[model samples]
Target chain A: MIDWFQKLGRSSLALFERLGRGGLFLMRVFAAIPSLVPRPRLVIIQLYSVGVLSMMLIVISGLNVGMVLGLQGYNTLVDFGAEESLGQVVALSLVRELGPVVAALLFAGRAGSALTAEIGLMKATEQLSGMEMMAVDPMKRVIVPRFIAAIISMPLLAAMFSAMGILGGYFVGVGLLGVDSGAFWSQMQGKVDFYEDIMNGLVKSVVFGFVAAWIAVFEGYDAVPTTEGVSRATTRTVVHTAFAVLGLDFILTALMFGSV
Target chain B: MIQKRTQEIAVGVFVAVGLAALVMLAMKVSNLSSLSDQDGFEVIARFENIGGLKERAPVTVAGVRIGRVKTVIYDDKSYDALVTLSIAAKHNQLPEDTSASILTAGLLGEQYIALEPGGAETMLKSGGEIKLTQSAFILEQMVGQFLFNKAAEGTGESKAAEGAGP
Candidate 1:
């Protein structure tokens, strides 16, 4: 009983320690924000790696997800003789839920992992230590740019995903299913409110981006300076980011959509 | 790194594409493009019950959309629902005696305001009250009234039979 009690206490302490450390790291990154503006070049490079490279993945996933939604939504809505609302059903689902959540998950798996690995490898190689020795704060030179790139790229990527998904739905819903193209578009426009649906979705994606990026960088920076530690940190970044995105998505959806 | 120029161009393209997608979403998929800032005249319509009539619900004339509901509020003095409609300036020729009715699109769908043009020479101006207004049809209320009428008829029939026997 004592051993079990001791283990639980130790683990809880470690978790709290990690939380505090992550909080401090986030503050430091925020402090480095003004310094990042002058060095757009660094951020651009990071954006190319994290954002540009992830585009193909986001777009493809969005298209496929949208197509599936169209197919399933049509099958269900047709029973009610509401096939014309396929576009509205698909668009609302994508914009309000799937777009941000799925995009963020994909981003976490792709860019988040890459960020963690890249930074972890740098730490393991003592590159961060070397920079610190030269009086260069690696937080500013290294972490801030990548972090900012993640934040900037996320909402844009999510938007693209939603747009692509809507097209995919259109292709399947109107093109394949012979649903009237005019009805499809008009119904969607009539139902999906800009402020309530799309804007709220954008807000969700931004929050997801902030949380995912913060988790990725923190996991990497906190990684032990060893090869095994780097690998573990990369895995943790993806896992942590996934959990954070999903959990935060629920909270955000409730806050944004919940009438209560 | 391939080249600084190449990297910047790629990033720029990515940003551009993402932004374009967002614009498409806002304009095509959503109703943002249809949301115009043109000046419009406001008209108030009083209804016994608004039902599911919401703000931003399309206000149509002869099945063609010309404006939107600006507000739905309770008029404590009149003990009725007051709906404010913003009709587009181009549709300013609507007659002052026009009748507004709360209508549903389908058996069960969103409710909107429909205007039937009245045979009048004067046009409705801003802040004008539409005297002829109809409340939304409530399915449950109708069903309840129907059941109540049936029960009352059944009782009346039994009472009539008893009097005839006596």
Candidate 2:
């Protein structure tokens, strides 16, 4: 009984300690931002690696997801003699929920895991320490640029995802199925409001990006400097980011789309 | 140096394409392009009941949308629904005595305000009140009235049958 109680206490304490460390690490990254502004190249390069590289994954997944939505929606809507509303259903589902959530989840697995692994490997090889020895702030040079790149790229990727998804939906809805092209486009335009639906979706993606990037970098920086440790940190980054993105999505949806 | 330049170009293209997608979403998918860039005047109409008539619903004339429902408010004193409409400036020549009625799009779709022109010398200006207005047809009320009529008819037929037998 005593051993079990002690174990529980130890685990709780460890959890709190890790949370505090992560919070402080995030603060350091924020603090490094002003210094980072002078050098845009670092951010640009990171953007190329993180944002540009992930484009294919986001776009492809978005298309497939949208096509699936179109197929499923058509089948169900046809039963109720509401196949005309397929466009509305597809656009609403993609813009309001799936677009941001799926993009962020993919971003976490793709760019996020890579970020953790890269940073962990750098630590294992003592590159961070080498920079520190040269009187360079690793946070400013290394972490901040990557973090900013993530923030910049996320909304753009999500926007692209939604756009591609809409196209995919259109192709499936109009081209494959016999739904009227005019009706599909007109219905989507009439129903989906720019502010209520699109802007709110952008907001959700931005938040997800922030959280995902934060977790990725923090896990990497905090990893134990060993080969096995680096692998573990990468896994942790992906798992933690996935959970955070999904949980935050629900909260954001409630706050943004909840009122009406 | 060449490698660096190509990479930078790729990044630029990526950003541009992404922004283009956002624009397409705004212009093509959503109502931003259609609704924005127009300064319109507001007009008011009162209805007995507005039945699912929401704000931002289309205000149409002869099946053509000219404006949108700006606000829907309940009048405390008259117990009527006062709806404000924002009509585009280009459509400024609508007659003052135009009739406004609530209409549904499809069988069970969105409700919009339909306006019919009247032969009047005067034209509707900002804040002008449309005098002739029709309320939305409530489905439940219609069904209830229908059932009541059927019951009344049945009772009358039974009474006639009893009288004939006696």
Candidate 3:
């Protein structure tokens, strides 16, 4: 039993090592040919997919999160006769952790999976092979554009999420709960720091984008022509990328903030 | 080909608008910060203990944040907490004999400094220290006291029943 457990652990470690190496290799390949691709066009496509398309989800989710936080936080603060601090609590929680992480996860599920499947289908159809045979590097042509797009998109989406969430908290806490709006905004302004919490969230989004794109591309490139293979790869890409993003978020948060 | 081109164009426009929205939001937040900075005052309070009183904790009057906690320092000589607060300049004139208390937001929430104004003719100036202060009410102690009181009540009730019995 012990030997079986040890073997399981070893296999898991080996799997992670392979993934890390593969991700690193893809990053390097894309990094080496920066100027070879059309930067502006790729960035525009990324902006559309990551930012504009993501706005509705970001807003809805952010508002609900903010409202729930305010409702819970206000109740607790009222007990100690410090209900006015609800604004600070809501804002800090939104900017520091919840907003960025949730936004990234949503983005990964919505767009990241699609990106992987699209690339996977292209691979299965021999299009990528044809591009490579014709001396058009797949990394520069397909992967680079998606990579650049995701990096740009995730941060912008996170910022939108944070802002919308704060507004939602404001409406629920001040308007619905009867807490003073002035007090709420003032407390939030006084307590929250853009450089520390908000900036950290943006940086995390950038990293998430990279992970999502890499997973999609890797799965797509390795996909078999069979329908089942494409379906499995797509599912794996989304599930694994989401978990990886969450795990990476915790490590980055700890490193950036130093024990919360 | 037309559909693809149009989709790409639509996406491009969407990205522009999203970026613009973020920039505007940032500008608005910054503006709000500056406005608050221009109009605020300061006061000082002392406490026995400030459990989780952060630097930017709100100072509320009737559940309104008229001020914020500026700093917290330990005074070894008096064994007290010296908390400085920044109030909105308009609300600067506070009664001389005000009471300051350390309060928790919830069961496990953050703590803050609460100011209760006293009925006095004279107003306090900047750097003035509030003398009458209350420390945070520890939850464990409160729960312990309640349980003990309940047990005592039960014992007294049983003794009275024994005395009344044949």
Candidate 4:
């Protein structure tokens, strides 16, 4: 029994070590600068696909989340005769914890998976190897444009999400719920600090963007150049990047707010 | 190519409608609420504990927002929570002997100041202080006290049973 337990522990350690090495490799890929400049056409395509295309989903998700939070918060506050505090509850929750993190997760699932699949297909077809033979850098030709696009898109998406969410909360909390609209706005304006929560959310999005792009690209590039391998790589990239984004969010929250 | 173009247009229209709805909602919310301004009349309150109390938390009296908390500063000399409240012009008639308490809206909710007006004839002025204040009632402390009391009762019951058995 003891021997079996010891073997299990060793296997777990090995698994963690492999995951750590993979993460480091992805980070290095992100840090590497390409010799050739990314083409404007590629950048535009990436921007459109990742940013503009993502707007509807982000807005829909953000609005619903806001409405739910408002309803739940109002219900709880009504018990204590503090129904008016719903504005602060909704605004603070949206700005601090939900807005950036949820947006990042959504982006990772959608754009991040698409990126993985595209690159994975190229690798399976030996296009990446062919480009290398032609003295063209695959990372420059492919990864950099996507990386830049993801970084640029994430902050904009997060900002849009936060704005929509606050509006949604207001509609449900004040308009439908019969709470005075003036009171809600006043409470929200007084409590929310743009510098502290909003700026922090934007900064977190940049970091998440880098992590999501890097992981997807790395997984796609290192895939076994087979059809089955490409599919597996795409799936793994989305799952791993999503979990990593959530984990990093917790770490950043703890570091930023723990001492306070 | 034509089909793709039409599909793209449809998606664009959908997104535009969604964005418009969100904007309309925002305008409605903004128009409805009134926030207290800084440089207004101030009132000070004391609290033992203020959990998750942000600097700009609203100070309400009987569900009406009369003011906002300007700052939450700890006075070393007094060893108490010195909360500075910024009251609106309309609510400037708060009595001098009004009681202030640190209250929480819900379980694990944000903390705020709840002002209970007193019957004093003299109204508080700018930079005046509220003398009577109650601190936040911590749920954990209450639960701990209850458990301790229950344990004491249990011990007393066991002691009586032991004596009767002898």
Off by over 4 Å in 3: A1-17, A36-39, B1-13, B20-32, B35-166
Q: What is each candidate's DockQ, to 2 decimals?
A: 0.86, 0.89, 0.20, 0.08
TM score of chain A per candidate: 0.99, 0.98, 0.88, 0.88
For residues A1-260, write the lDDT of model 3, one tens digit per residue. Answer: 99999999999998998778776768665674565455667556555665667778877888899889989999999998778888889877877788778888888778787777888888888889899999988877777677677777777777777777777888889989999888787666665666666667667877887787678767766677667788888898888887988899889988989854
- Candidate 3 on B53-100: residue-level lDDT in tens? 877777887666677788889989989788888887888778989888
* Best model number under TM-score: 2
What level of docking quality does candidate 4 show?
incorrect
Worst 10 residues of 3 chain A by lDDT: A32-41
With a 3 Å backbone cut-off (N, CA, C), the pairs that clash in candidate 1 are none
How well is each residue in A69-159 modelled by candidate 1, as lDDT tens digits? 9999999999999999999999999999999999999999999999999999999999999999999999999999999999999999999
Report how far off residue A117 is in candidate 1 (Å): 0.5
lDDT of 4: 0.76
Per-residue alpha-carbon lDDT of candidate 1 for residues B1-166, written as tens digits (9 for 90 to 100): 5598899999999999999988888889899887883478899999999999989999999899999999999989989999999988888898889999999999899999999999999988889999999999888998999999999999999999999988
TM-score result, candidate 3: 0.66
What is the DockQ (computed on Cα atoms) for candidate 4? 0.08
Alpha-carbon shift of residue B9 in model 3 (angstroms):
5.8
lDDT of 2 by residue, A25-131 (tens): 99999888999767999999999999999999999998999899999999999998889888889999999999999999899899999999999999999999999
Quote the positional error of residue A232 for candidate 2 in Å: 1.0
Which sequence of candidate numbers ranks them by DockQ, best first? Answer: 2, 1, 3, 4
Q: What TM-score fits each model?
A: 0.95, 0.97, 0.66, 0.64
